[model samples]
Target: MPHVPERRPESLGQAAYRQLQEAIETGALKPGDRVSVNALADQLAISRTPVREAIAWLETDGLIVHQPYLGRVIAELDHQMVNELYALRFVLEPAAVGMAAKNATDAEIDVLREMIAFERSVLDDPIERERHNRRFHNALYRTAHNRYVISTLSALQTPMILLGPATASDPKRLLDAYAEHTELVERIAAHDAEGARAVMMRHLTGGQRARVSYLLNQQRS
Candidate 1:
């Protein structure tokens, strides 16, 4: 019989959490998928104890919910949740973009530009493109110079990842996003705070529409 591979000693709880988190983020586990502690422990080559511990944490995070008899399942992504997410984004991100335009240092602006370039380079790889996109936005949030906003936005990362790969999966959409990002960056570089805010609002609105469309299509399929 095959034995569990021992790569190195690590915190089993943390390791299992990371494993499950990645699966959920990448849609490998997917929305509403039933989670089996025994099967997951086997898959991760770990014990059920750590898996249960991780599951308990995930429950607290609202990423997984316990049903009466079904145990824990990945939380469902619905239209209402999408609306609430975008509503929060609309309120937070435009302010972030405006602040970034007015307050970002030269080095911070340069980092943002480099991130856009990296995003463009990964057009063929949706996962990497999305990763760079998140990096760019995180940098923008930091450049906003609001520690509170940064912390709040950081907490949203997991759900943002759970939104799936639909938006970045299309080549044309990527090109369009690049253009929008270019405009946003140019405005920020010029310290046109209002212009940057406008562009960001448009970007967020477009993203929301795309997400709704993707979710509707998935429902039909």
Candidate 2:
């Protein structure tokens, strides 16, 4: 039999970009970790060009900093950045949930219910519970039928992971969050746009409080 041609792997640059992005999102690349282009290329079995490109992309996204002679390092989270992120969420998520109430189909509501059930089942593991919580919120945003809202919310996911663990780690916080989600879903199901929006605002507010408290405690320590 004639030898078959092997399929080409993804471009080295694309692979490098994806791997680096995941590392940044999952906290594997912590703040201030130096970005060694040569070492990254060697480790990922790629070339210098791609690693450089990946670094450039991260720099543009403000996830990494480029310093003269010092090279690039993962960017640190600051108070202002955290405030701005939650502020943006406060403006956007309520609107998305309100719109979802008006436009979401019966099938979408069913999907939301399933998401809630999944979240409830994962309450013992904070990380897994948070992941499911994020999924539920993302699904609500998607159901809003607004492309920009969905895009903006999706971009916030990496920053969320960087906030250091879930507020749902506390049993009380987790239960309260679940109740808020349940109320929001009920409002959506009933086509109560204003009610859903109010619930969403409260949800985001509670989350912001938890995250801010965590950051403040970290500073104190």
State how far residue 107 of model 1 sits from its true place (Å). Answer: 0.8
Q: Once model 2 is optimally superposed onto the true structure by TM-score, how far is the C-alpha of residue 148 displaced, in angstroms?
A: 2.5
What are the lDDT scores of the predictions, listed in order? Answer: 0.84, 0.82
> Model 1 segments beyond 4 Å from truth?
1-10
lDDT of 2 by residue, 141-184 (tens): 89999999999997876567555444455677778899999999
Query: In each prediction, how many residue pairs overlap at the backbone (N, C-alpha, C within less than 3 A)?
Result: 0, 0
lDDT (Cα, 0-100) at 218 in candidate 2 = 69
Candidate no. 2 TM-score: 0.82
| lDDT agreement of model 2 with the native | 0.82
Winning candidate number (lDDT):
1
Error of 2 at 114 (Å): 1.4
- Candidate 2 residue spans exceeding 4 A from truth: 1-11, 67-69, 166-168
